[model samples]
Structures are given as C-alpha cells and as structure tokens.
Target: MAVKVSSQKDTYKATAVFLVLMGVLYLLDKWIDFSDYNLDWVMQKDTMLLYAAVTFLWFKSDKSVGLILAGIWLIQNIALVTALLGQVSTYLLPLTLLLIGVLLYWLSSK
Candidate 1:
C-alpha cells in the first residue's frame, strides 16, 4: 500500500524533532555539570537512537515501520540498554519481547 502524504510529513516532523532534541541534549551535556546526577549514559548515541525510535513510533502513521526500526535498534543495542538498567537487566529481554508482542497485536488490530 502507498503511504499517505500526511504520514510522510509526520515522519519528517518526527525526524526533525529528534535531531533538534539530540542537538540540544549534546550541547547541554557539554556545557553543564551533570556528574553528580550520574546521567552520562543518557548522552550516549545508542540511548539517543532509542529515544528517536520511540519518537518515530509515536509520530508515524505507519506504526509497523517504526516498530520494525525500533525493534532493530533495541536488538542491536541490547547491551547498552541492559547495562543502563543494571540489576534489572535480566528482566529486560522478556519485558521487551512482551511489550513488542503487545504493540504488534495492538497495531494489527487497528
């Protein structure tokens, strides 16, 4: 099926928002002292991409595309995400799979 023009526009808007947010975040990291907060992981590229993926999923009309991309990003960066979760890392995979399944079922129903 062909994508609607409005869907494409939404995707573009999502991308622009992601880029601008990332830029602001990077600058903030550089200029601010966040060491006490231990939020360095939030500035990582993988984390940013995950955020972008979620943003795309939220904004895109064709959710399957965003879902696929988000899944790929999650799979590829599982280690980073898991590490960020520390003691909760062991539950990450199962939770992620469950969430994906739910999202897929929901999207298919729509």
Candidate 2:
C-alpha cells in the first residue's frame, strides 16, 4: 500500500521527537556526568535507538525505505551492544531492538 500523507506527517513528527529526545539525553548526560563512557560508544547507542524508533513508526506508515535503513542500523549495532554487554547479554542486543520495535509500533498507534 502507498504511504498516506498522514503517515509522512507522522514520520516527521517521529523524527522531531527522536531528535529532541536524543538532544535532551546528551545534555543530561553531560550535565549529570552520567558516565565516563566513550563518546563513540554513546553515539552508536543513540543512533541505534534513533533509527529503531523511526523504523517502527515508518513501518506502519508503509514507509518501506525507512524500515530498511532502521533494520540496517540495528544490524550494524548488534555487535556493539553484544561486545559491550558481554556474555551476560548473549541475547540482549537482538532482543533489545526487537523490544524497541514492538514498543515504538505500539506507541505510534496512539
């Protein structure tokens, strides 16, 4: 099915929300000295979260192209999440993204 104009509007709104959320997180982390984590690591995590949210929102909107990108981002970050979390998270990386997708899909419905 073709994506409706309303879906496009939803996409834009989702993008705006995601960006604002990331900006706030970044500032809060710096302001609170949340962690002495590596900048690259944090950036990667943020990117993953951003795309996952966007992807789920876009999917229901019939935005196939965006879904491809979101899936790619999640795929690229899978190793990172696993390596950082280690054996304790043998399944966490995939599950995390899946959970994100499910949550975002549900949230977008409203």
Candidate 3:
C-alpha cells in the first residue's frame, strides 16, 4: 500500500519539526554560550511559544502564513547570531518574531 500525502499535512509536519529543532537550539544556547554568553531565558521561552503557535496554525491555514513565520524565525535566528557575535545586547528577537507572526496572520487572511 502507498501512503497518500497532503500539502497541509506536509506543511504541518515540517513546521512541527522545525519548531522542535529551534527549541533544541534555544536550549543549547542556554548553557553552551552560543549567544555571546547572553541568554535571555524569558525571550527563549517566548520564541518557543511562538513556534508552538505556528506549528498549531500550520494545519488548514494559508501557506504564506507559515512561510512568513519561518521568515521571521529566520530573522530572529540571525539577530541571535548577531548578538552572539558580540554585536549588541538588545531585546530585538522577540519583537521581530511578533511582527512576523502578525504579518503572517495578515497574509494568511488575505
């Protein structure tokens, strides 16, 4: 027997997997000093929550929304990288993720 696949199902799976990976990375960053020894525990928790929400929304929703969320995650990761590289120590990742979530929601609605 062959397994049938749906785009929505696939998207949901991808989003779920990505969220898990991100969460792991966040955890690693906590003790591993990946972010310039600057670990914002609260922000990490919030990002995890956002990823959870996106994973939940991946089902039966517009693909663009997920893409946007991913895009935002990409940006946050970049910012975290920047911070870790000793660039700056500002609270920017959470705001960027929030904007990404809202923008993705808007896009999905359109």
Candidate 3 off by > 4 Å: 1-5, 34-36, 39-62, 67-110
Q: What is candidate 1's lDDT per residue for 1-110, written digit by digit as tens?
A: 25577887988988888888888887888788455479877886667767888888888777766677777787888777788889877887688779979998999999
Measured over all alpha carbons after superposition, the RMSD of each candidate to the real structure, in angstroms, is 5.2, 8.9, 9.2
Q: Highest TM-score among the candidates is held by which one?
A: 1
Q: lDDT scores for all predictions? A: 0.79, 0.67, 0.62
Residue-wise C-alpha lDDT for candidate 3, range 1-110, written one tens digit per residue: 12334655666676767667787786776667555755555346547655654664556344556656655665657756666856333456556658877997999999
Segments of candidate 2 deviating more than 4 angstroms = 1-3, 37-42, 45-60, 63-66, 78-110
Report lDDT (Cα) of residue 92, candidate 2: 72
- Each candidate structure's TM-score, on Cα atoms with residue i matched to residue i, is 0.63, 0.47, 0.32
- Tens-digit lDDT track for model 2 on 11-93? 77767766776787678777765456554555457475655567456544656656676667757677776788999686776
Which of candidates 2 and 3 is the stronger one according to TM-score? Answer: 2
Give residue 13's lDDT in candidate 2 (0 to 100).
73
The best candidate in terms of lDDT: 1
- Could you arrange the candidates by lDDT from highest to lowest? 1, 2, 3
